[model samples]
Target: MMRDEAPIHAGKSGLRQILRVATTADHRVLDALGTKFDLASRSGYAAFLSAHASLIPALENLLDKGPVPPRWPQRRRAGALAEDLAALGRTLPEPADVPDLASPAQRIGALYVLEGSRLGGAILLRHVTTAQPDAPVAFLDHRSGERCWATFVEWLDGLDCGSDEQRAAIEGARLTFAAFAAQFRAWLATIA
Candidate 1:
């Protein structure tokens, strides 16, 4: 059975109101963005920090590689990310917008590798790429990790690709990341 009572409010600021509702929302991306800018809701803000706090060390370990080789297992063929993305593309109205299957696979592979290779106390740092002004680094823990769009951009950056191809891949990654982020933020608004 469902209650017919009106929604409750804990008396937070405008921004806080946004954050509180954002956490349980679909993308809940606002939770992430709010944390990034320190504009999160009191409860939501606390939750966000707690979530990433644990991963900090793991992420840092990856960053410590610093232009060094990654340590995750080698996945020469279709992997989790590759399969997931390919499947998603098929269900979409236009798969052309999606990058080649290999691109995302490489991305997931690189992130895994970077995390695997990270040291005991490693931390992940987010940096902006000079090449692409708006392209933010997706959980970089190493110096050479470079700025990427999403899991794929970082993955391709970790690989030994040509300048042109890398550029294209990064661009794709950025778009994917932004789209997901926006969608996630909208979803978060409806969280109870």
Candidate 2:
């Protein structure tokens, strides 16, 4: 009986209360609303919850004081392609309430354009600057992803592409991505 009064253990994380506040109208309930809720972490938790509502329960479960499940991967985005795909989902332009693509074709196309151009250049730059394998490895580790993306944008932004026809193509792609990325970030901030 005493244990029941003592925050009645609801899974390992802790006691959580969900409230359907009168002021808020929607599926949103005040998650983790409790007498002793930590105000310091509330904003961050809200952001995370907004981003990943489906996983909230699982996240709270894991927040309990114990070793996490063994099967979970260390990082959500494991490889280069996965990271690029995730960025496109988060960053590419779309309508305010329209659906993203069923397939990741557009994002992949953008990534290929970015990587093919800049990855080769980066490799060449590394080889020319230093003979040590570790130097190139470190460079790649620190800067490869962002550098490749920026180079693609730069190429699109009035950098010559050898011929007028090729230059026009690059410019079009650049403008499209630029417009889209701006809107996408704005939307992300709203939900963020």
* Root-mean-square deviation (CA) per prediction: 19.5, 24.2
19-132: candidate 2 lDDT, tens digit per residue? 111112211122212112221233322222223222222322332222112222321112322232243343222222211212222222223222333344355445433543
Query: What is candidate 1's CA lDDT for residue 77?
Result: 17
Q: Which candidate's lDDT is highest?
A: 1
Q: Candidate 1 — which residues are off by over 4 angstroms?
A: 1-32, 35-69, 73-159
TM-score of 2: 0.22
Alpha carbon RMSD to native, model 1: 19.5
**True-vs-predicted CA distance for residue 27, candidate 1, Å:** 17
- Tell me the whole-model lDDT of each prediction, alpha carbons only: 0.31, 0.29
Candidate 2, residue 183: Cα displacement in angstroms equals: 4.5
What's the TM-score of each model vs. the native? 0.28, 0.22
Q: Which candidate has the highest TM-score of all?
A: 1
